[model samples]
Target: MDNVKKRAAELLKSEAVKVVIGYTMGTNGKPRAAFIQNAEDVDSLIFNAQCVQNLAVYLSKAEIKQLGKPAIVAPLNVLRAIIQLASEMQIQENELIVLGVSPDGELIDFQNFSAIEKYLEDFNMEVDAKEKETLEKISSMSLEERWKFWNEELAECFKCYACRAACPMCYCHKCAVEQNKPQWIPVAAHRLGNLEWHIMRAMHLAGRCVNCDACHEACPKGINLNFLTKLMLNDAQEEFGYTGVTLKEGNLLSTFKTNDQENFIQ
Candidate 1:
């Protein structure tokens, strides 16, 4: 924690970054996002197991970007989000600086996106064992059983959109749910509406999900929306040998290869 504060303070004092995005103690004694513009406020920065919120979501905020050359204290997940965002041209490498934190709680000051990519080479990108086991269990279920399970789980949704808000990759200017021109999706939180909303969310994040699990964590109804995206990610890897956290040009769904199998096509 001390090292993080020191580095943040140095960046602020030197005017290297107009703002340093980090974590601080909230009213509930949990870690929350903190924007430190002054060097003196750097002491409030804290990093621990509770500091799981991905600060990368703030990078696209108009107000935050106006702060001028922001610096983010990023975890591995946030770093992956950064890479994904960079590949999508949502953000630039020189626009924001990254202060990466390793799994062992070590602070790694990355000079650029290339540095981050090189550093992440040694990091493991596998899904958690427990999550994998749960996915396997669901995959083993019959089609009707899986449908019933998902319908039951999604019935609890109240259209709060907490998952969408917390997802770093969900940076759309206007979501399909909010569109009223044709009302592509129903606004009501009925079973069908909820199911459609989740399916749309999962499809949008298909090959781009960084496996941060922020959506799952942000769900107020404890809905396992991350599972949907994880399943898609697994399929993407198996079918195309593609991973989201890379400097790749085109996404899985956007670009097609001649070698791609079309066994499902009639």
Candidate 2:
């Protein structure tokens, strides 16, 4: 932990990056985002499974941009988040630096995000036991059944945007549903309105979701929002052969290749 902190501090001191966005222990010792301005604060930064908040979410924020050329002490999920964000043009690729860390607290000193991505296929694991069970139950449902299930499940939503707020990939400066000029989404929190809002949000993240489950975790109503996203992940992989986020230089949605298939769209 100290070595990672020292390296981040050195980067800041040398002006290699203007700010280092990483994690520090939160109020209850849970991992939380920490932005280090000077070397003195580096000791506060730490990483572990408990450091669950995606650090990539903050790289595009106004305050972080003011610091200039942001660098992040990235977890695997955070690195994936950056790749997805970069593909969307939310942040410039050259302005960021990723300090890769392993699950066991070792520093992958020489590995950039791209290097880590190439090997991600071998490391992909299923979700936790309970989440896996939930995912399985959801996946087993028929399409119409699943549609009806989500409609009833999301009926409780009040358009709170809690799911959007928690998602690392949902960084739109002004979300469409919130706009009054177009008034695309109804303000009423009925099943019809709620379902459309949720669908729209999930579709926006189709090729980009890193599956951190932050959106579901952020849901106050306890809706398992991953029901929609996980389905999209399967479709993106199977139909388009566009596997989602990796630490790779170009994410599935980042660019268009002439050889790519568009049959799914038609």
Give residue 66's lDDT in candidate 1 (0 to 100): 85
- TM-score of every model? 0.95, 0.82
| Model 2 misplacement above 4 A | 110-113, 119-122, 125-136, 142-148, 246-266
Task: Give the per-residue Cα lDDT of candidate 2 at 201.
Answer: 81
lDDT of 2: 0.74
- Please give the range of 10 consecutive residues that has the lowest summed lDDT in model 1: 242-251
Tens digit per residue, CA lDDT, model 2, 162-235:
78877888888898888989888888898878888988987887777888877877788888787678766766
| Model 1, residue 114: C-alpha shift (Å) | 1.2
Model 1 RMSD, rounded to 1 decimal: 1.4
User: Which has the greatest TM-score?
Assistant: 1
Q: What is the C-alpha RMSD of each candidate to the true structure, in Å?
A: 1.4, 3.6
RMSD (CA, Å), candidate 2 to true, equals 3.6
